[model samples]
Target: MELLRNARDAGARNIYVASVLRRRRYRTLTVLDDGQGVDERYATLIFEPGVTTRHLNPTIEAVDPNSPPHGAGLSLYHIRNLAVRSSLLSAASPTSITVTFDTRVLPERSLQSTTRPSRSNLRATVENFARTSRTSAFYYAQPAKILASLIKNHIIHNDESAVELVELAEALGLRISTRTAQKIKNGEIPAIERIDGSGDGGRRRVMTERGGEVDGSTALLDLGDEQMSRIAVILREAAHASYVEVHDLRQSSRPGEITLTARVREPEDEYE
Candidate 1:
């Protein structure tokens, strides 16, 4: 959510948060930023792991991995491929970063709604999705990079197991099905895990350690190639039947297409 906050901080003139591409109901979103560019020579320099220009500023000098520098320096430059944008090449004075994400690939987003949901009110709908934390820095700036990184990097504060896959997906503003839920469980998609350890020993586990993780047997796509191809085939058949199916498919799938799982520590959870 800090990414949302930072977006707001940059006083970003244009905020275009929308679905860029879609897969078998999955979406990959692209967030472009026109904030002041990095040093042309240092365009690629910012993304190197453990690299940050924030240290130059005394206020942000005490840089803990947790206490990230300005959101700019701390986002996922490490996995530029995941973002699939040229950090160096794209980051001219007006820089842009596009993040491609896997939907249903995470638990759900957390809910911290201050107000109750109202069906009669259109304002409620907008407000529900509206950015709540007004001052978190990236609120106005594009959050794709930071948010994708946050979920990918497991940098947020929370207990992974305490949160369910569907719940984490909600936190990220997406959804899934029982089959999808089972995949998250089966795949153990790194960021969040189920609190499934035996006896009382398990209850004491930290949130980060409790959630499931991706393993060798897990298919890269939660739905697997067969299901995805099957869905694609079904869609193709529907499309052959009617052009309306194309619109229906897109409209029904957009929100969930762009999903991100909660970020988890690699190889080990801090809780353990």
Candidate 2:
């Protein structure tokens, strides 16, 4: 959270956060931002306690009298101490910070313990931060998971141009060529019902297994047989989906088309 706040304070317009597992042993968290970056000379010094370049803005302080008078500068210091390994890279513009935790060195408490954070946990963290963030924030996982996050968060809607979608995908480390992005935008490759209310062609509605209806907000993704379990994990974790239903729309009209839908848990629903 402090890392995100630091980026925001640096005047970042776009921030990307990624949680990755390396060799099934190290859990890594990377935060990248397109903001005024730190100078190479001060990169190491910025992580020291009481070291900061920020000053309390008078406008913000006037708005909130309870605001701190100065930056404490302990955020990066604390973050560095908590992680097994951490590094910072900066240039004139974009800056990146990575923190890795070694699973082997961490204490085990449960039989179901895992080395890395679950998809749901990562999604929830990003969603909570995005609720009040002034800048755009993206969370990266697998390619399919990233696409799902983009659509679910309204970062990439059906109306978005193929170029825009491709650019966003590239930022998340998913290299989508212009042709594939165009196909996705046109509902051609990995074809699914269009979400935009264009005409009768886009009139289809998604239904959950419990008979609930999903409106135009439903996210669509194309997946193969082997990718079903991966997508299921994302739906279950990120959306707290009760159940997922798959419909094989493959026919003469749309060859190899498959649609996946899930029931997102409402706020009123009891937690399991």
Candidate 3:
């Protein structure tokens, strides 16, 4: 039902649904569409709470004031919350959303045997599985979106060290390596990059560079300035009491000159 809503929201006139048992205990549910597909930038974020592209346009609120709040972007989020594993594959030519559900709790023989159960019994089992899958919700809820942008801005403007950024990330509950921080600083880890689909509307591909090897797809993180600032302040306060984002250290440095500043708030009032 939620997938249908997303397909309609994407302006897909004809959506195809396919289900198959890939392994003994795994089932894949794929939804194919021909519409304005999601960009690679928001591929992963579409499942995060309160993220949406549908809200960009003027919705039908003016036509019907009594309408419920639309474009919460919660459909995919909830779908992901329900599924054991989920994925979104989008292309300019053809868009698709695929989700996998684990049916391992029930033996494969029970569902796929020659002596199949009644339609009502099978439906009940499927519904029960859906209900119970919520126990395995995704839990990586650190403010990574904010932390990524904060690190990017600090690297560009404040000349913050990778070590410092990693420290701050860890302080704020995000665990990233020094190499990842360097990649982000060097623009190798872009916030977003376009994927080139094949001429025959084949699979979507994203190119990435790591250890001199061009790798497969990478998703982008979309973090707004306001969100970054708010989360930064919160994280800073939590990590170090009373210290804030002061720019006095950069006043005397030449443009692009790297310098590290260690600021401590003195109880006595004194200006640096």
Note each model's CA RMSD in angstroms: 21.4, 14.2, 21.9
lDDT of 1 by residue, 69-115 (tens): 55555555634434433233344322344444443552223333322
lDDT of each: 0.36, 0.55, 0.47
CA-RMSD of model 2: 14.2
* Candidate that beats the other on TM-score, 1 or 2, i.e. the better one: 2
The runs of at least 3 residues in candidate 3 whose Cα sits more than 4 Å from the true structure, single-residue gaps closed, are 22-24, 58-65, 69-71, 104-272
TM-score, every prediction: 0.33, 0.50, 0.36
lDDT for each residue of candidate 2 in 133-252, tens digit (9 for 90 to 100): 535544444343444344544444656688888876555444457777776666544322222223322224555445655432223444555576776666556654444333332312
Global CA lDDT computed for model 3: 0.47
Write down the TM-score for model 2: 0.50
Of candidate 1, the 10-residue stretch with the lowest lDDT total is 247-256
Candidate rank order under TM-score: 2, 3, 1
After the best TM-score superposition of candidate 3, give how far the Cα of residue 81 lies from its true spot, in angstroms: 2.2
